[model samples]
Target: MRTLKFLLQKEFRQIFRDPSILRIIFVMPAIQLIILPLAADYEVKNIKLAVVDNNHSDYSRQLVSKITSSGYFQLQHFGSSYKEALQEVEQDKADLILEIPSQFSKDIVKENEASLLLSVNAINGVKANLGAAYLRSIIQDFNRELRLRWIQFPRFNPEMNIETPSSNWYNVHLNYKFFMVPGILVVLVTMVGAFLTSLNIVKEKEIGTIEQINVTPIHKYHFILGKLIPFWVLGLVVLGIGLGIARVVYGIVPVGSYLTIFCFAAVYLLAVLGLGLLISTYTASQQQAMLLSFFMMMIFILLGGLYTSIDSMPPWAQAITKVNPVAYFIEVMRMVVLKGSGLADIKYHLLTVLGFAVVLNSWAVLSYRKRA
Candidate 1:
């Protein structure tokens, strides 16, 4: 225990003595947490819409008003002809074009049906699909409202219907920032912890400092713990800074207990920092450590369920996330923040990370060379 104590002191001193390491530990994650969440948002808004209103009747104008007032759409161009409206989409000014035929209003009133041409620019498929769907929903609502108003008059048959009102739970307004910020915080903290720890040992070797340590009576696991403990604490500190930014700047407060988050984070740091140490044990230089770290970081982020749903992935990719430490933490962050899930709720994930910590740190300790 005394040996471990002196070793930790040396590691912390080395970390604080270097200005570059200090910035990488404290400033880098804080800055990235502030910026990345805003950029990583997925909610598509401000869909540019073009309208070609050949009917020019009260019903047609009312339909246009319904669309623009829904807050999902912005009327970029209003044209008298479909060709002009199509030009708006062709020029990339509009994502969708709604064309009303010459007798559209007349047909809707007299025949209860009208033809509507929707031209969508499929360049950005997600935007095009979602924008078109929103427009169609707005038009359908307008049609229902028209039917309700028409029924108010002396119509022979009247039908009453039951409507199911739905509410959006967790995120009441479907705020994408609410979902993204926590996951970004996880990634930022993980990257800082893993990358710096990976580079630290490799740098020591490059400068011939590691040889001095290897010649000592200090046990191998003692050296590994000395390296792991400081960065594990810093990882938690980064998590704290991220949560503060999430609260003060983004207005995100985790509904779950802070204890649960910290508990998961403490175990999570072990797994992440252990993985870094494992890499450091195998590599001879900082360049090789960096290359390997980058490769692993890419795999962790891509499969981490940050932007994509794991359920939607193939069975093979889904199986890979079982071993991806980043995926587990990101999933836990969202669950605790969005669902108010407690430690009991994430027990399976906790155990998985614990297993990772034991395996990785043990591997790192065994892999380290004690002799020249």
Candidate 2:
């Protein structure tokens, strides 16, 4: 117990004395939490649109007005030439082009049908697909409006329309920040816990201080606990900072209890810190540990359902997420914050991460050598 206390004191003093470490622990998470949610938005907007108006008719003009007014698109170019509109797309000035045929209004009136051409810049597939879908929906609504205007109703009977209204659960405003902030927070916290711990032992080795520690009558478990506990506490501190930013900057408060968040975070940090300690045990230097940590972090975050849905991934990729600790934590954060999930709800995730903590920390302790 006395030996572990001394080790803890030394680790904390070492951490606080280094200005670079202090900046990384406090400053980096703050900036990333504020900036990442704003930039990592999934809702596509401000899609540039080009139009070729061959009919010059009221219906064609109304169609163009409806599309621009829908708020998803911007009118970048409006001219009478398809060739010019295509050139705008080629030059990257337009994301998509809307071409109305010369007989657009006449065909709709006389034949009750009309053809429209859409030329899309497929370089950005998501924007193009969403833009085309938005345009099509507006055009369909316009078609329905025209039909309603021209149709004659009998006095004895009236047409009845069925409407379906949708309610957005959890995120009433559909704010992307609500969805992204928690995940970004997890990533920042993970980076801190993993990268910092991974480099710890390696740095001591490089500075020739490790030899002094190894000569002492210290138990390996005590040494591991000393290294793990301080960073584990710091990891929770980082999580608190991120949650504060989430509340202050984005107005997001977790629907679930703060106790729940902290409890889960405590265990999650053990797993993450253990992974870092494992890396530290294997690597001989800080540079190698950093490169390896970055590589592993990339795999964890990318498959962890931060920016993309794990369900949408291929069967094999989805299988990979089951083993990923980051994926479980991100899912648990969203569940607790947005859905007001209880500890009972997250038992699966908690147990999975706890298992991770046990395996990783055991491996790190066993692999760490007092001599050699």
Candidate 3:
């Protein structure tokens, strides 16, 4: 107990002695939690739109006004030709192109139908699809309004009775920031535990202190614990700050138990710290540890449903994410925080993260050598 206390004191002192490290430990997490959530929003807004109106009619002008008035679109340019509209989109100045045919008004009057050409950039497939869907719905509503005014002898008014009732669960407003903030917090915490601890251990090796520690009476488990506990606490502190910001600044509050979320976070931190220890065991230099940790972090974040849904991924890719502790942690965090899920709802994620913690810690302890 005395030895453990001494080691813990020493570890804390070392961490605080370095101002840069302390700043990184405390400041970086908060910055990332605040900034990344704002940047990673998936909600499509202020989408630049270009219109090529060849009809020059009142109907075409009304359509343009409707498209612009919809909050989803911002009219940037009026192109005279399809080529110019396409150029505006291709040059990244516009996200969508609305082309009204030359005989749009005549076609609608004679044939009772007119086609409007809508070209959307498909690079971000989901956003593009959503934008296109919004545009189509607006057009459909306009056409329905036209039919109601033009065709007065309507029997039963079939179109008016046909309604598509839509309700979004968990997130009624569909705020992408609310969906992403919790997940981003998980990623940021994971990064700190995985990257910082690994580098700290490797730094000891580079500075020739690892050999000195190996010769001491300090137990290996105690040494590793002393090194890791501070980081685990720091990660949790970061999680708390992030949650506060999410609630206060973003107006996102978890409907579930905060204790339950913290408990899972504790388990997740163990897995992340274990991974860091494993990396430190293999790396002789801080640079190597940092690089390896960064590469692994990228892979885990990408596979962990940070930017995309895992359900939408391929079967093989989803299977691969099962081994990733980040994936389980993020899944459980979002479920509990956003969905108001209970313990029963996240049993698999909890168990999976617990298993990872045990396996990774065992591996890290076993792989660490007394002498390099």
Candidate 4:
């Protein structure tokens, strides 16, 4: 107990004594929590739209007004011809192009149907899909209104015949920031654990202090714990900053117990720190440690569902993520913070993270060299 206390005190002093380390440990996380959530929104808005109004009638004018009023799209180009509109989209000046066919109003009045051509840039698949969906919704609403005004029911109402009720849970308005903040926190914590710790450890070796530690009477596990404890606390502090930003800036409240989330965070910290320790043990220089750590961090984060949903990933990728600690933590954090899931809901993820922590820490302890 005394040894552990002494080691803890020593680690704290070392962390606080270095200005760079102090800033990284205390200030960086807060900055990331505040800036990333606002910048990382997936809910695309103000998409540039080009319009080619060939009909030159009240119906085409109304359709253009409806599309512009939806607030999802911004009218950037008013092309006189379909070729011009297509050129705007091809040049990346517009995300969508609406080409109203010639005599559209007359066709609709005569045949009760008119074809409106919609051309969308599919480079960004998600944004293009959203744009298409918004266009479809606006057109559908217009068609419904036209049906109501033109076709009158004799006795029964058509509204009673078709009822499509929809409800959204957890995120009612589907705020993309709320979904992204937690995932960013996971990425930041992983970067700190893997990249920062590896560099810090290798720095000691480069400075010749590792040799000094090798001659000390302290046990190897105690030294390793001393090195890792500070980083573990730093990770939790980052988590706190992220949570605060979610509540204050993004207005996202964790629906589950904070303690439960912290429990998973603690386990994740152990696994990440253990991986860093393993990296430090193998590398002889800080540059090597940093490069290796960076390579591993990228692979882990990409596989960890930081930007995309793991369930949507290919089966092979999903299977690989099961062995990645970052994936487990990301899953648990999203579930607890966003879905309000309890331990029972994420027991399998927790167990997997626990196993990773055990294996990594065991490897770190065994691999750490105490002698020159």
Candidate closest to the true structure, highest lDDT: 2
Residue-wise lDDT of candidate 4 within 226-318, one digit each (tens)? 888888998888788778777887787889989888888988899999899889988999889989999888888899988888889999999
TM-score-based ranking: 2, 1, 3, 4
How large an RMSD does model 1 have?
2.0
**If scored against the real structure, what TM-score would every candidate get?**
0.94, 0.98, 0.93, 0.92
TM-score of 2: 0.98
**Model 1, stretches more than 4 Å misplaced?**
151-161
Q: Per-candidate RMSD vs. true structure?
A: 2.0, 1.4, 2.1, 2.2
> Which portions of model 4 show Cα errors greater than 4 Å?
152-161
Q: Between 1 and 4, whose lDDT is larger?
A: 1
Per-residue lDDT of candidate 1, residues 9-120 (tens digit):
9988988899988898788888888888778767678999999989999989989998999999999999888888888888899999999889998898889889899999
Candidate with top TM-score is 2
3 versus 4: better TM-score goes to: 3
Cα lDDT computed for each candidate against the true fold: 0.89, 0.93, 0.86, 0.85
Better of 1 and 3 by lDDT: 1
Per-candidate clashes come to 0, 0, 0, 0
lDDT of 2: 0.93
Cα shift from native, residue 96, model 4 (Å): 1.7
lDDT of 4 at 320: 88
